[model samples]
Target: GCFWHHHDCYLFKVPATRTAFWLDKIAKNVARDRRDIGRLAEQGWRVLVVWECALRGRKKLNDDELGERLEEWICGGGPCAQIDTQGIGVLDVTSPPYRM
Candidate 1:
């Protein structure tokens, strides 16, 4: 199943020597969510978190449309530039691959 997240929202395809985190009970699993995000960022992955608030107010939105839009955003398509028909700023991302 496809998620509403863009491929580059985090370190999706990097040589990450790490895993993600959860809100609770991580470590027996991984680590705290904020920690994981910060680690990935420190390791040079451009991360973008889509909080619950961003998912709300989309009554007429179709899931597929959002997924496609996300893909475009992660592909360096420019987000903070254009305003959508709904007058909301698109949050596009661009992360340079980390060098060893």
Candidate 2:
């Protein structure tokens, strides 16, 4: 059920209406995610936080490529990792160390 735990899974983009409220809400959600991740780490459970932006948009990796990367990570020995977009290539959170 760890994967079902609520975290910053949604990409909270500020809408045209209620921009201020949305910003505040997203800030709180991000803070909560950090706390939860820290707690999981303390319990020796690594967490991977792949942002929605990385999985969508014009620069996202192809589905096949994404699946390959995920498969590699799951089968590998890394404790934690995240796949994100950076420029043209995908950013490896564990290797270069990406924050949020």
Candidate 3:
């Protein structure tokens, strides 16, 4: 389901089995994601991507911090952004007020 006010929140996952198939599928999914984001942005919607790494493992952020950061982004009026692990670096999609 869609989030409040057209915000699309997706939990991306890639299966370990079928390496070649998964890679191809994931690549297609990434392309679709970019296309969808661009179309949505054209309609004035905001996107916030929360990577799996940001919610688990040794480099994860605490629940409270995550919540705060999400709230800040949603209310802070950022056009597009992503929250990921330090090691994952960041993705710059370039949609104004965008960040990693």
lDDT of 3 by residue, 15-87 (tens): 4678778667555556666778878888998777776657876767788778777777767746767776542
Q: Which prediction has the highest lDDT against the true structure?
A: 3
For candidate 1, what's the RMSD? Answer: 12.6
For every candidate in turn, the CA RMSD to the true structure comes to 12.6, 6.7, 7.5
Give model 2 RMSD, 1 decimal: 6.7
lDDT of candidate 2 at residue 14, scale 0 to 100: 50
Query: What tens digits encode model 1's per-residue C-alpha lDDT throughout 1-100?
Result: 0012212222223233433432122222222443555566668665544433224444323566556655655776432322222222433333311110
Runs in model 1 lying further than 4 Å from the true structure: 1-31, 50-60, 77-100
Give model 2's TM-score versus the native structure: 0.61
The TM-scores of all predictions, comma-separated, are 0.33, 0.61, 0.64
TM-score of predicted structure 3: 0.64
lDDT of 2: 0.52
